[model samples]
Target: MKKIREIESLLGLPSPSNISVWWNMGSLLGFILVLQLVTGFLLSFHYTADLYCTFNSIIHIMRDVPGGWFLRSMHANGASFFFLLMYIHIGRGIYYQSYMMQPRTWMVGVTIFLVSMGTAFLGYVLPWGQMSYWGATVITNLMSAIPYFGTNLVEWVWGGFSVGQPTLNRFYSLHFLLPFVLSVLVMLHLVFLHEKGSTNPLGSLHHVAKIPFHPYFTIKDIVGVVLLSFIMLGIVFFGPNLFTDPENFIEANPMMTPVHIQPEWYFLYAYAILRSIPSKLGGVLALVFAVTYLYFFPVTMRMNVLPMAYSPISQFFFWQFVVVFGLLTWLGACPVEDPYVNIAPYLTVMYFALPILMQVSNSIWYKLIIS
Candidate 1:
């Protein structure tokens, strides 16, 4: 009864009354994560991690196992949905400057983001398709840029000189394990969130009245879940292949590489940043910094500008960042030549610079207001 009371209290915890539909992203993300876990677990029973057998095993699941196709489709599509909602959730946090109010939760959320990407990458390689194999090779080989021990680290991860059976087996095992880790991290995130409470859209918690989570936000979350479910199921049943890469449909072949290779859409922006830099090590570092840079935001943007709503300049830079992000994603998919290649480095610079500009503008706004 004590545990039940605690749970009840949590469900009824007060939330910002002003939080909009964007706040519903967190609930939707939770739903997608559970869906992915269930489908992934069911699909794993028949999956073979051997390099030679891996691709065929996937085919077998689709063809032979009852409802295996549905499970596989749901799992694959769920990943896309998961990232989509997570990005929106993170974007909402950024736009509202929620990080400054709850830095601990924000940092943990960023860590979760990185781990989620790692888990997705591991899962991508499990199918042992052409793009999957080469994607693993290309990404793992990036480790060789890590200086003296880089090559050794790459080999150790591969369990051989090249991507082979050991690589597939290890990736499959890690992929299976990381979701459990994500679940724990998620709980930690919620703990931190509950500790600080939700920040309102206006970014001011000062004397703001709160409402119970039950009927108000719970209904909002349900609406989001229903809408997201409609879209995700429509994709699952009508267009499962919409997010799939054509190269991934082919079996992995060491001798034959695809004319163009790219990761899933979620990764394209970072991939563009990687490709933008000319130096191997430099590009790898840029890619690392790209995703992990969110950690520094809380400290950098210390001004009392609760949200972008108060500052027009900061809002302008935020929109610019969003546009740059979209451009990078598009550039990442384009062939690495001429105009596209040239544009990436410039956009990468802006991508890193925009946040700094936002901070500067907001700080200026703060100074003027103080005077």
Candidate 2:
């Protein structure tokens, strides 16, 4: 068929040499996306979006539905692991300077990450558990810091003065819809990838050396997927609650807030940022700006111009930044008092400063070598 021939042609196009294990991350992310979609669809069949019934529905699914507990645990734990892999994937891109050459691909990937976060946040509220209710309340209320329109916007988002039935319904609908959008974005991401082709560790262009995607990379991807699935299955079967908040085990109660409110592990870094600042508006703006500013890294940061892997100093800073990010994630889960709160701002500063430091270090290193 013409279609098959065209597909063959696309697959036959060349890619960069020395791609290594880092290249497998994009495919790995794609694999996780598929798993999330399949499990989410199955869970949706048994889930109810109503605030009054949402908690009970989740309980019913866990207790009554055949293999429902497994499905829910897999879906839940999968989210944390998905974020873990994504952070690594993004970090790998930065380390290898993959974003510099294929800016569009990197940009699309960032968009996918943001959209995925939104989808996950919406899904987290569906259980209507203690953390779910208050987490939604705390996060949505952050919008109330937008000067004149803040309170009104917050009310509009909640569909009432507070988080209630309407909030749950809206979140459920959007959560169901977002995965479809993410799939489309992923297709676009691949289109951009194929257009520019992949950037390998050696930073070679596609024209210099390329290979067929199918059979070669396909087999590689399958191996990575299988390995990742095994790890995910172990967690789903054996330690489902390892990463979840125990407070969420209780049903949602608007009257009483948890002693220490926190979000799912993935949101911990941003949550830490939110709690670090004194001003509500400042915290809200900081969160939004933190992510949006990443889009400008390719433009504003001078180090992005460097041959990244060749620069030892830049590589060191890049990995250090990742370690700091992990630390922030852990700190976010801690109580927002004393040492945690006191330490958060310093960590947050380092978190934002890493890229700039890499840029500076890379620039100086380039000059020293040239001079």
Looking at candidate 2, what is the lDDT of residue 259?
94
When summed lDDT is taken over every stretch of 10 residues in candidate 1, the lowest stretch is 299-308
> Per-residue alpha-carbon lDDT of model 2 for 1-371, expressed as tens digits?
99999899777867665678878888888888888899999999999887678899999999999999999998898888888888888888778777777788888888998999999999888888899899999889888889899899999999999999988889999999999999999999999888768887876664776677777888888999999989988988888889888888899999998998888888888888877889888888878876666687677655334678778998888888888888888998898778888998888788888888888888888888888
Per-residue error at 81 for model 2, in Å? 1.9
Number of the predicted model whose lDDT against the real structure is largest? 1
RMSD of 2: 1.5
In candidate 1, how many Å is residue 226 off?
Answer: 1.2
Model 1, position 16: C-alpha lDDT score = 86
TM-score of model number 1: 0.98
In order, how many clashes per candidate?
Answer: 0, 4
* Candidate 1: tens digits of C-alpha lDDT, residues 1-371: 99999988898888988888888888988999999889999999999887678899999999999999999999998998899889889989999998898999999999999999999999999988899999999999999999899999999999999999999889988999999999999999999999868989788655459888888888888888898889988998999999999999999999998998899999999999999999999999999999999999988877555368888988999999999999999999999899999999999999999999988898888778778
